[model samples]
Target chain A: MNEMIENLLSHRSIRKFKSKRLNQQQIETIVCSAQHASTSSYMMAYSIIGVTDDSKKERLAEITGQSYVKHNGHFLIFCADLNRVTIKATNDEYENMLDNLENSEHFLVSAIDAALAAQNAAIAAESMGLGICYIGSIRNNIAAVDELFHLPKHVIPLFGMAIGYPAHHPESKPRLPIDAVYFENGYQDHEDALDRFDEKIGNYYAKRSENNRKDTWTDQMKRRFQKTIRMDVTNHVKNKGFNKK
Target chain B: MNEMIENLLSHRSIRKFKSKRLNQQQIETIVCSAQHASTSSYMMAYSIIGVTDDSKKERLAEITGQSYVKHNGHFLIFCADLNRVTIKATNDEYENMLDNLENSEHFLVSAIDAALAAQNAAIAAESMGLGICYIGSIRNNIAAVDELFHLPKHVIPLFGMAIGYPAHHPESKPRLPIDAVYFENGYQDHEDALDRFDEKIGNYYAKRSENNRKDTWTDQMKRRFQKTIRMDVTNHVKNKGFNKK
Candidate 1:
């Protein structure tokens, strides 16, 4: 495989980072690489907030329940921002600004746009020899996150990413078997493939150097999905001016 | 910049593709690269459905209103899948399985995971001299798409990506100014940046070789956001069993 594909295939989330900061030039180049990611209709309905204040980082770390948030070289919150388009609509005196921004399709569009850009940033960071971790737990306290970031309506903070020099290199976790996650022509039954993956992951968890455990993938998934996870996000999304229909 | 960053910085969506098909090995390698992308909490809540049948491709093309879907080297629908976890929950006899699978946080997690994987797949394709175009228009007719792909509940079609050898190379579209999209510490006003970007994009449209026009970014966004762009997506999402409170 080529270097780009090799870099992509070897991706591992880094939770421990050295006490060093990315220079301003590096941050700018990374963000520029993010901007180059394809946007739907060139809408670029996303914004990234770089948090460097220690107090603010501490607060965000508390929100995510991940202490590393404060110590990472940099923390960036990626948001699905319809506000830019809203601004244009208002500036042009469009009558359906609210209605247009409130649609579920646009919500999905912005979220996907943010995600696509964030992934680009992640890959770029990796290519530059920086380790990165995506903090989806930011949603654990979405309201506080929004308030902390001063996010306006039509701008939902989707996720946060932490980039820094690696202090630890963890083994890449196993994924579902190809058959289980890839269907040919149409969706197919993958129970057999899932069964195989469960065995493989069970072995992986047991063999990993850190956080070793005897948990199968199915066991963890069952534990997670046995009850509601983050039920507050519905209200949070609505309060952030989305899914209003 | 290294080759990877340079490749990322120069991404342009390829709408027209050569008629050649990707070999089995190429498809497997690309899918494996996609599987390597990061997932939230290791919940690999996504699936890719590859469509190669001409009839199915034609139907999908009609749904997207983009004829290139039929002619692309390969087409894959990236789905935000909670069904796998739901199956584990059901088989494990976990209470509240339905409620857990229906939450908005999991919905966002699965969609982001799928997008990350798709972007990796796109980058991998680009690395191999293949071209990619993301088809967000798949949402234009979600129910039909679900039916076409035999998708189940809790498995929404997030987006489709068409990959193939390039038949036409388009110029990279202009993005919002860096200041407008990247904030420091907290959100800031970007009116001046947007105005400058509008002028720059106006020039971009006027100078591009193919389908050249005099439209500004603001003009396009204003036209798009004037009314509901895809109002049916709400019902479609709900019918696919998501965003329910």
Candidate 2:
């Protein structure tokens, strides 16, 4: 693989990090790269908040239940923000604009915008030899996060990123088989595809260098989705004036 | 900027391709990079459909109303798919699993997964000198695209990407001011941030080599949101068993 592709493929979520801050230049580069991502209709409907204050980071750490939130070299929250666009549009007389802003499609657009930007930041950070982890746990308490960030309506804090020098190098987690995730011309059923992958991942969990355990991917997934996690996000997002049909 | 950061920042949506299909190795590299992106809870809730059939591409082009969709070097539909996970989780007795899959948070998760994957693919493709453009207009008639792709439920077609050797390199479109998108510790407003960017983008639109026009970013956004475009996506996504609280 080429160097860039190699960098993309070598991604791992680093939970532990050495005590080194990502300097201003590095953080700026990350945000700059994020800003350049392809936005839907040039809406640019996302914002990156780089949290540097110790108290705020500590509060975020408590909210996410991940100490790395406070201790990471850098903690950045990616919010799907359309409030900026509303400000620019400057015409409240246009009811369609207001309604459209609340459309689920815009919701999709903004969230995708954040994700695309974040992945660029992730790749950019990694290319510079920094380790990173996506803190989706931030969504576990989205309302509190919004309160912490003072997020405006139509600006949902989607997720956070924790970046730093690696204190540990965990083996790359296995993904679903190529056929299972890739199809040609049409989507295919994965009813049979998981058996081999389950075994492969079971082996991975059993023999990996750290935190080795014996569990199949399916079992983990079953344990995961067996409960309705983050169901409150629906009402929270709606209360934020998004996904209103 | 480092080479990769330079690559990330220099991204432009390439609408015209040289009619060169991405080679197998390049395609594999792109897909590999996508698969390696961080997924929420290892759910890997996404799929990529590579449409190689000319007729299928033509149909998708029709659905998207973008002729470039059919003429690209390679066409990829990045889908927010949880159908595979449902198959793997396999126990019909698990009501919560079924409920969780339909949760709006899962909708967010799957879509973010797809976006993260696509961004990696975009970076990988660009690094290899291939160009790409995101085709979110596929959601214009998502039901038709779903019909064409034979997608299962919970496999929403999030967006399409057209990849190829560039026939033309468009100048990078200007983004919002850094202060507008990046904040310190909290979400911020763009009330004043747009004035400078409006001038910058207005200049870009007036002076650009291709499709030059006279307009500011504010005007474009106002024109964009004034019409409630793709409003059917909400019901379509609901029909596809997503965003169900």
Q: Report DockQ per prediction, comma-separated.
A: 0.80, 0.82
lDDT, candidate 1, A104-151, per-residue tens: 788888999999999999999999999999999888888888888899
For model 1, what is the C-alpha lDDT against the true structure? 0.87
Alpha-carbon deviation at A173 in model 1, angstroms: 0.6
lDDT of 1 at A25: 89
> Model 1: residues >4 Å from true position, as ranges?
A91-95, B91-95
Reference-based lDDT, residue A231, model 2: 82
Sum up the clashes in candidate 1.
0
| Candidate 2 C-alpha error for residue B215, in Å | 0.8
**TM-score of predicted chain A against the true chain A, for each candidate:** 0.97, 0.96
| Each prediction's whole-model lDDT (CA) | 0.87, 0.87
Q: Which stretches of candidate 2 lie over 4 Å from their true place?
A: none
Give the docking tier of candidate 1: high
Q: What is the TM-score of chain B alone in each candidate?
A: 0.96, 0.96
